[model samples]
Target: MTSISILKKWNPRPTSLSQMNALLLRIPVSSPSMSPRRYSTRDRELQSAKLEIENAPIIRNNPGLSASVFRNLSKFIRSYDLMDHMLKVYIYKEGEKPVFHQPLMRGIYASEGWFMKLVEGNRKFVVRDPKKAHLFYLPFDSHMLRLTLSGQNVKNGKKVLEKYLKSYVGLIARKYSFWNRTEGADHFLVACHDWVWFSCINLILMS
Candidate 1:
C-alpha cells in the first residue's frame, strides 16, 4: 500500500485518558502550567479562586465529580477579590457564569450548595414575614441575661439542652410530640454549628 494509505489505516483515536495524555505529550502542544512567569499576576489570582472549593470538605467528599458544585466553585475562584467574591455570589444568580472569571483555582468543593441553601432557608424561616411578628436580634450578653432572668438554662447546661445541642439532640428534641428521625434531623445535626455562629456565637471554628 502507498504511504498515505498506510497512515490512514493505522490512525486511531486515543481511547482512554492515559492514552490521550500520552498522545498530547508526543505533540508540541503547550498547556497552562504552574510557571510563575507564564501567566499574568491577575491570571494567578484567578487561579487562586479555586482554592476555596478545593478546601471545602463537601467537594472533597464527593465519590464522583459533581458538575454543578464544580462550576460554582470555579466561579468563586475566579472572583477578582474578596469583595468581588461577595458581590458576584450574593448579587447574582449562582446558575449564571461570569466570563470575567476564569482559570479557576482547582478541584471541586462538592458540598457548598446543599449547605448554603439550608442556611438561607433557615434564615427565611426566621423572616418569612417580618410584618407578622417583630424580629428581635439580641446580643449574646443580653441573650444570656434574658435567658437567666427568665430562668431558662438553655445556654449554660451541657445536656439539659434547653438550647441547641452539638449533636442532633437539638433537632431530635427529647420532647417533641411529632418527633421522627425522618423529619430532617440530619440536616439540623450537620448545620447546627452554622446556626449557632449565625445567631451570635461570636466565634468561628475551622474544625
Candidate 2:
C-alpha cells in the first residue's frame, strides 16, 4: 500500500472537537531491510516502541482509567507509559517570531500557547538532532498567525492562512527529508484557532 494509505489506516480519528486541536498522526514503520548499522536510529526506536505497545498485556480494573474516558484503557495506559519513556520530538527552527516560534499567552487559545511553550522548553522530549526524533513538530501558533496575517486585509483570510501553512510545509519538505519520508505521517501541529481545522485541512489530508 502507499504510504498515505497506510497512514489513513493507522491514524486515529478524533472523538470530539476538543481533540481536534492536537492531531497526532501515526507513522508506519516497515521492517528494515538494511543492516543495523545502516538503519536510522529514529526508525529503530519507533519500531521498538510500536512492538512494545502491540505486545503489552491487557490490564483489568484500572482505577486511573475509566471505560467512559478510554476506548481501550490497557492500550491507552501502555501507550502513555511508552510515550513518557521513549518519545522524542524535533521542532523545526524555521520561520520568524510572533507567527512562528512565539506564543500568545493571553486568549481563549492560550492553551495552545502554553503547550508550545512547554514542549519547546522541555529538555526530556525535545531532542536537538532530527535523526533521533520519532516525531517532528511545526511550532507555529494559530492565534499568532491569525493576529499577524489577518491585519493584512486579505480578501479571504482563511485562504491566506491555508496558503501560508502550505508554504511552510513546502519549505520544510524541501529543506528536510522527514516530511518526505512518510508524506508527513509523523508530523503534528497544535492549534486552537477556530479556523485552524478548515485552514489546515489540505495538510491534514496529505497523509
Candidate 3:
C-alpha cells in the first residue's frame, strides 16, 4: 500500500508521515506485501526484539555488510522508540511506515529513501558493491526472517530461507546451487545464496 494510504489508516504522529512516504516508494513491484499491515501483539514483540538481535551479530554472518549499513540500522532503531512504536505500527496502525523511527531490523522500513534505491540497483552492484544491499534490506528483516523460520521454527530458519528463494519470480536463487552441485546456476550460489551467511541474507529475503 502507498504511504498516504497507510497514514490515513493509522492516524499516527505527523512526524512519521514523511518517513513513511520515503519508505513506501522504494518497495519493488514484485513484493506487494513488501509492506506490512500491522500484526498481533505477540508478533510485534518478536519483530522488535529480533531487530535488536540482528543488529548485534549480523556483520559476522555477512562480511560484505559495510559499516554504513550498520550505522543506518542502529540510527533507525534508536529513533523508532524501539518496540513501543513498533507494536503500535503493527497492531494499532495500518502499514509498516510508522516503523521508521524504530530499530532498522529489516529493509521493508525503507526510511532512508535513497538507500533502498541503491539496493535495487543493477545486479552488477551485487558482484561489485555488495555492501549497498545491507542498508536496503534492514527493514524487511522481520518478514524475511519469518518466511525463513516458517517450517521448523528455530533450526528451520536456514532451510526455510532456501525454500523462500526457490519461490522467487525467476527462481534464480532456486536454480543456483549453494554447495558446488551442478544442479543450479553457479552465479546464484556464489552471489545470492552465500548472502544468507552474509549480511544481506535478510535483505535477500526481502527482495
Ranking by TM-score: 2, 3, 1
Query: What does candidate 2's lDDT look like per residue over 115-191, in tens digits?
Result: 98999999999999998888899999987888788867566766677778888888988998787776776788998
> Could you tell me every candidate's TM-score relative to the true structure?
0.19, 0.77, 0.21
Q: Candidate 1 versus the native: TM-score? A: 0.19
Better of 1 and 3 by lDDT: 3
| Candidate no. 3 TM-score | 0.21
Best by TM-score: 2
Give the range of the ten consecutive residues with the poorest summed lDDT in model 1.
92-101
lDDT of 3 by residue, 67-105 (tens): 444435444444444534432211111113322212332
Q: Give the best candidate by lDDT.
A: 2
lDDT of 1: 0.31
RMSD of 3: 20.0
